[model samples]
Structures are given as structure tokens and as C-alpha cells.
Target: MVQQTDLAIAPRTAMGRAVKHLRQQGIIPANIYGHGQPSVAVQVDALAFDRLRRAKNTRNFLTLRMPDGPNQTALVRHVQSDAISGQTLHIDFFRVDLQERLAVKIPLKVTGESYAVKNLDGVLLHLLDALEVECKAEEMVEYIDVDISSLNEMDDIIHAKDIKLPANYTLATDPEEPVIKVSPPRAAALPEEEVQVAAPEAGTPEQTPIAGE
Candidate 1:
């Protein structure tokens, strides 16, 4: 089951350029909308939201506590950031129905050592980093593990269909797509002296001798 964390938020009246003042005071402007409900403008403490974002599992459901309204269960839909400074600019909270299934992308983590990579000096290629899955809010997961121990030879691959998901989770990605693979080790380059010695001299018969000496 997914874990839930409490986040305190309050309705905001700031809009457009005026909201920058809130950020100057260490508060972030945000919105809450979903389930055919009217969108709400809100704000949260920058430090608190930062802590929640840096938490172990970013996929956790957030219990938005409001002083004037009942608590709401929401998912972080999007976080806008300043490209150069990497500062949080805005946030979007998506309210969800706990019992209703929703599609979301979950990260994929490579687990277990591959025999081909450990013993054969092969390269491991991770083709997919995340998978889209459909599941109820309560069934959400932080990440799915893809074990590679079964890859014993170069060129061996693991496809999406091979992944085993948790109960109540259904894959939304193509099953036949390759997720990971092992590639043969690259050949070492020969020494310059070896190449020079292996080549024929300029006057050697191997080269078409001057037409009619």
C-alpha cells in the first residue's frame, strides 16, 4: 500500500505577477484540480514542500490540510522550476479518488547482478527507465525492480512482458518492448607497432606492381 504524508496548504488570492511576492516570502503558488471539481488556487510553505519533495518516495499521496476546509488527498501532478537556478516556481496538485484506477509513470530500478556483466565483461544496456502503469491510488508504488541476474549471455534481453508487477497494478506500456539487454564487450585496439608490421612494404608484390616494370 502507498504511504500518505500530510501537507498544510491555504487558499491564495495572488495571481499573475503578484504571486512573485509570495515566493519572495518563501511561499509557493499552486493549484488543485481534478475529479471534475473547480480548480483552486493555493499556496504552501516553500521549505515544507521542499522537504516533502526530497522525501524517500516522491510518489506518496499528500493529505492537504486546510484550515477552513476538509483535508484532501492529492498527488503531485507537476512542479514548475526555474531552468537555470533550479528553483521551484509553481506546483499542481491532482486530487484523486482512492478507489478509482489511474495511470501514472513509475520509475524502474535495476536490481541483481547480471552474470554476463560480472563474469563475461559484457555491457548492460538499460533501455527503459520507467513504465506507465494503471492502479488505484492505494496500490501506487515508488518504483518497480527489474532483476537482471537471469541475463547470462551477451545479447540476452529482458522485455516489458517479463516484468512482474505487484497486485492490483496493470502495465500500460507495450509488453514486447525491450527493457534491458547485455551487449558483448568491445574489442581492444591493436598496438601501432603490430599494425605497422602486419602491413606490406610500399614495393611489396601484394600491391599491384607498377604496370610493366
Candidate 2:
């Protein structure tokens, strides 16, 4: 079984504009609800949640330790951030059941060098960065490793059906969708040459006979 990361949070009483004060104090306001229960308001240390997000992200299940209740397994459902600074403002966690299956998009992790990219200088394009998969909470994964070493030509592609999944997990995305591909290297643009036009030779005005002639 994959080890789950632990996140500790405290029950929150602040609501409305008062929640802004929590953020100023390095506390992020959050809500936790799932399994058909009313959402509970909570708060977590900004620094701690940041570390946890960096380590486990939203794909893996988190062991949530609540102040007034039992620890629960949850998945990060939504994260609201400061548009400019990218600071985390709030979060939403959904409680999960270990024995039940759930669908989530697991990030794709590329591994190994592709012969097309290494030898032919082909560009590698990731058509899908994540895979929609269904699995139990205990079987949730942080990311799926994709091997690109099999790409031997510029047009070579990898499809959803080509990737192997964990024993309990199944792909929810279409099997024929292209996951990754190698494209021919882009051609460099040629520098434009400066063209100088010779000044028009000094010319004398042509004289015409008077119109009444």
C-alpha cells in the first residue's frame, strides 16, 4: 500500500470577511465534507499545507487529522489562490472511503529518453498531461509514469491504451486518444536581407507644349 501524507487542521469558526484575517496570520481557511455530510469549516497552517501540496499534490489521498473529530482520508478537491501572487487563499477537501472507488485525474510523469527526440531531434509533445483513472482511495497515485523510449520516429505516438496501469486502477479516458507524440523539429527562420534602393537620379521636369497650342 502506498503511504499517505498527513495534514493536520483545526476547526474554524471564522466566516465571511473575518476569514481574511486567518490568511494574514498564515492560516488558510478550508472546508471538508464528503460521504454525504455537511461541510465542516477548518483552517490549516499555510506553510505546512504548502509543503504537503508540494510533496503529495492533490492526486494522492491525504490523511486528514481534524481537531474535533477522527482522522479521515481525503482528497483535495479545490484550491483558491491569489490571482497575482499565486498565494493559496482557501482549500476544499473531500472525504474519501478507502474501500470505495473514485475517479480522479492523475498527472503524467515522463521517463526515459525517446529515440526520436535524441537521435532525430524531434520535438516531444505531451497531448495529455493527466489520465482520468478510477481506483480505491488506498490505490490512488500521485502520478502515472509514461515511458517515451519506444518512440523511434518523428510521427510516432503513444495512445491512452498503450499505458499500463496499477492492478486496481482503470483508465477512464478514451483508449484511442493520443497521449504523447514526437514531431519534426521546427525549421529556423532565415534572417531578412536589407535591400537598399538607389536614390532616383536627379531628373529635369519634362516641358510640355501649352494646352492652347
Candidate 3:
């Protein structure tokens, strides 16, 4: 639900050393392509891109203000990172139509401690972390919350259709997907049995000594 201001970018950023120079200046070199339009290389301010990432609508459409032509509204389709520095080195922007639906992946955040872990002495296990959804680009969500307070048994499972998602969004993952499960604590180790001791040799040292003598 967060909003970001228009991002300013340069129109013509060429290949090879020129793009490397862009990265050297704390500016991330990127490309915007989609809606069947030709791809164009661009340079976005690193500081500004960081702000947009923290704005809670990172995967959604953003208003990109190019240098020359009309400002294009784009969906942040792909982002490439520098392997060593972990910086945003490249990005792909997709031109979007506001009314059109886009399939995107949404994160699932689990909340609340189960009584199965407290009163019943059990452990909580979460199976699924993120799920895919189909919705309007503008309706995309940052994350979904799944509450586990209602779980009380060892076999309790939280299903996709059970937890609530954004009304504007539709779950693309199967409804039977298990998000979380509660199980009883591990069983105590069993006591080891005493092993039987073997009898000594029938012949004694005295017999060997007498025979040698």
C-alpha cells in the first residue's frame, strides 16, 4: 500500500564499459522492457532505487520518468544483483496496463504461538513460506498473515483456503497447500538393556604352568 515518487532515469545507456562506468558512480544500470515494446537500457539513481525497495511495493508497477520521451509506468519484473557487493546491478521493468492482471509471488507471514507448543508440549513447523497469486498489478500485496493460535493438537495443519488473503488478490497456489503444522514434542530416549557377561576360559593359568614345568 506504500507509494513512491516518480523515478528519474536516463534514456540511452549503451553496453560494455559505458554501463560499468554507470555502476562506478553509485548509479545502477538497468533495462526496461515489456508490453511487447523494445527494451532500452537505463540508469537509475541507486539511492532512489533503495527507497523504492523499502517502500513495501517493490514488485508492483512504478512510475518511471525517462529523460526525453513520455514517462512510462512499469512493473518491476526482474532485478539482478552484483554477486559480490550484493548491489542492484540490473533490473527489468515491464510496461503495465493498470486494469490488467499480473501473476506474482506473495510472501506468507506466520503469527501467534500455538497452545500445542505451550500447554500440550509440542513443536510448531511451517511448511510453506511464500505463495503465488494472480491479481491486478495495483492490488499486489507485500505479505499475508497466517495465525496459528487456534492449533491445539499434534496433527493440526493450516491450509491455504483457511487463512485470509487480500480481498483484491486470488491465490494461484493450490488451496490444499499446508502452511503450518503442530506436532507433539519428541519422545524420550529408551533405557539401554544390560548385556550378559561371558564366562572365563575353562583352563586356568595353573594348568599351563604345570604342563610347562
In TM-score terms, which candidate is top?
1
Whole-structure CA lDDT of model 2: 0.88
- Give the clash count for model 1: 0
Scored by lDDT, the top model is 1
How well does model 1 score by local distance difference test?
0.90
| Residue 198 in candidate 1, Cα distance off native in Å | 12
* Clashes by residue pair, model 2: none
Tens digits of per-residue lDDT, candidate 3, 54-149, equal: 875566557899767888888788889979978888888888776788887778887888888788877788788888888876666667889898
- Write model 1 residue lDDT over 100-149, tens digit each, in one string: 89999888999999999999988999899999999988788888999999
Q: What's the C-alpha lDDT at position 104 in model 2?
A: 84
The candidate with the higher TM-score, 2 or 3, is: 2
**Model 2 agreement with the true structure over 1-213: per-residue lDDT tens digits:** 456778899999999999999999999999998899999999999999998778765556788898778998888899999999999999999988888998888889999899989988899998999999899877777678999999998789999999989898889999999999998876622355789998756885767899999
| Model 2 worst lDDT window (10 residues) | 184-193
CA error at residue 34 for candidate 1, angstroms: 0.6
